[model samples]
Target: MYYLSSDLFFPSVSEANWDGVLAIGGDLSLERLQLSYKSGIFPWFEEGEPIMWWSPNPRMVLFLDELIVSKSMRNILNRNIFTVTFNQNFRDVISNCQNIERDGQNGTWITNEMIEAYCKLHELGIAKSVEVWQDKVLVGGLYGIDLGHVFCGESMFSIVSNASKVAFIALVNQLKKEDYKLLDCQVYNPHLESLGCREIDRTDFMEMLKGK
Candidate 1:
């Protein structure tokens, strides 16, 4: 993988390896993060590891019009079982994502450093959050980078069953209403696929990211 220097720069995403590691050892400063997402790249590394940047070949994304809501989920959404809000509790949402346990994962990639950095992005209005609450208690939420037409999803957490799904659907509907382009899921996973996220060529994603 390419190594980053202190100077504000990044190798082209096309230089990434087969595994999609474009570079390593960069600090997560606000400027770098902003440029990274805009270039269709993102940082993902566990604690103690140098910040690793990636731009996967088969990048996973969800077109707003393509979000899938099952009958059970649609019924729950129709019932309004949870209240969804935007940018209400960003730190809480990201913190929960860092702490929540997930199957097949021994630890979270969302490190303390990342939390502080993204929280700063939130302050600058480049990052946004969606919060899901039930009976006035926070149970599910998500956070991501907002590129106007594209949203780069960072992480999400759900304490109650299907709470995350509720938050996701709300985000999709809101983005649809705003005429957003797509949700960048970064990588492929079963959960994201179940929700209608699919892979596209990195070049195609870049074109879309450019609003082409």
Candidate 2:
């Protein structure tokens, strides 16, 4: 229930309520966004609503060693039917994520303002994207903040079945090779669980964010 100002500061994650909503009404400026992510806070508000920041307890995360690639996914990866690239077309990847329709959702959280803000972060190498290409067509991708040892995944979209999955798998493999510690999924979903993402106490997650 805290309110933010132009100071680019956030209350401690411990101050978050039961729903994880830590505060409301903040600009998505680069400084504010960077400070928020570094502190394990992120904005997720629907259009027409003031920006809402959250740092949910029981944070959902995926450790590289714990990734679960299903047989079908393995077959797909083995087939080599898709090409994955990083930071090659972040703007497109994020635009697709903004437009792709999702079940049980009427509109996108990736608003025009959000897109511009994240793109700024990407240009500064603090944000990144994973793109899935099939026959030279961009079919699926995802984007998130890269906090050195931890990657905070924001959103993903797929135009074809399993396309997003393909992108996600590629991302995990790349992070593993790069020796990243964890992938912060923010919240839980069945799809991510099937991919081996599990929830840990938010305090533990914050410690990991600090490279502890």
Candidate 3:
């Protein structure tokens, strides 16, 4: 580990670690947060932990065209039981994502500082959110940074079954309409795989980030 700056300009980061912890200890000011995501980095740490940055190797990403809606999911979409919208109720979305308790996780990584930081970013238009509503109740949503045509998805939550997936589908559809190059999922999981997210080398991913 190298000495990370309290100020945001990342220290010389190492690709080997793939942790991509360029800097730490800085408040997630809009400028720093925007700059970090522009360079394919993001913050993830517990409330008491010094803000940890990450850019994992073999980053997980989903192409809009690759999304695989299953038969059941397709049926759900066809029924249109839920309504999807963009940038609606961002605060609520983040709040739910932060407050929702997950199995196995001792506590939320979405610290108060993180929440305020992202809220600030949302106001600046660099960060965006996708919301899912069922009969006017906010059920699911996600938020992330938008660097030119790439969307680095930060986090998502579902209050109801398939709600998160519905929100993700809307996000992908919107990104496709907007001509985004990629939807960076950061890390891989079985759920993301089922949604068509795949791993790509960090170098290549960065190259794609730069190319766009």
- Best lDDT among the predictions, by candidate number: 2
- For all candidates, the clash counts are 0, 0, 0
Report the Cα lDDT for residue 29, model 3: 78
**Model 1 agreement with the true structure over 1-212: per-residue lDDT tens digits:** 78899988888899999999999987999999999999999999999888999999999999988889999988888888899999999999999999999999999999999999999999999999999999999999999999999999988899999999888888999899999999999999999999999999999999999999
Per-model lDDT: 0.94, 0.94, 0.84
Where does candidate 3 stray beyond 4 Å?
A: 12-22
lDDT of 3 at 138: 93
Tens digits of per-residue lDDT, candidate 2, 1-212, equal 89998787899999999999999997999999999999999999988899999999999999999999999989988999989999999999999998998898998988899999999999999999999999999999999999988999999999988999998988999999999999999999999999999999999999999999
Query: TM-score of the candidate numbered 2?
Result: 0.99
After TM-score superposition, what is the CA distance of residue 25 in candidate 1 from its true location, in Å? 1.1
TM-score of each prediction: 0.98, 0.99, 0.94
**Candidate 1 has which clashing residue pairs, if any?**
none
Measured with C-alpha atoms, the lDDT of residue 113 in candidate 3 is: 81
Q: lDDT, candidate 1, residue 42?
A: 94
List candidate 2 stretches off by more than 4 Å. none
On the 0 to 100 scale, the lDDT of residue 130 in model 3 is 93
lDDT of 1: 0.94
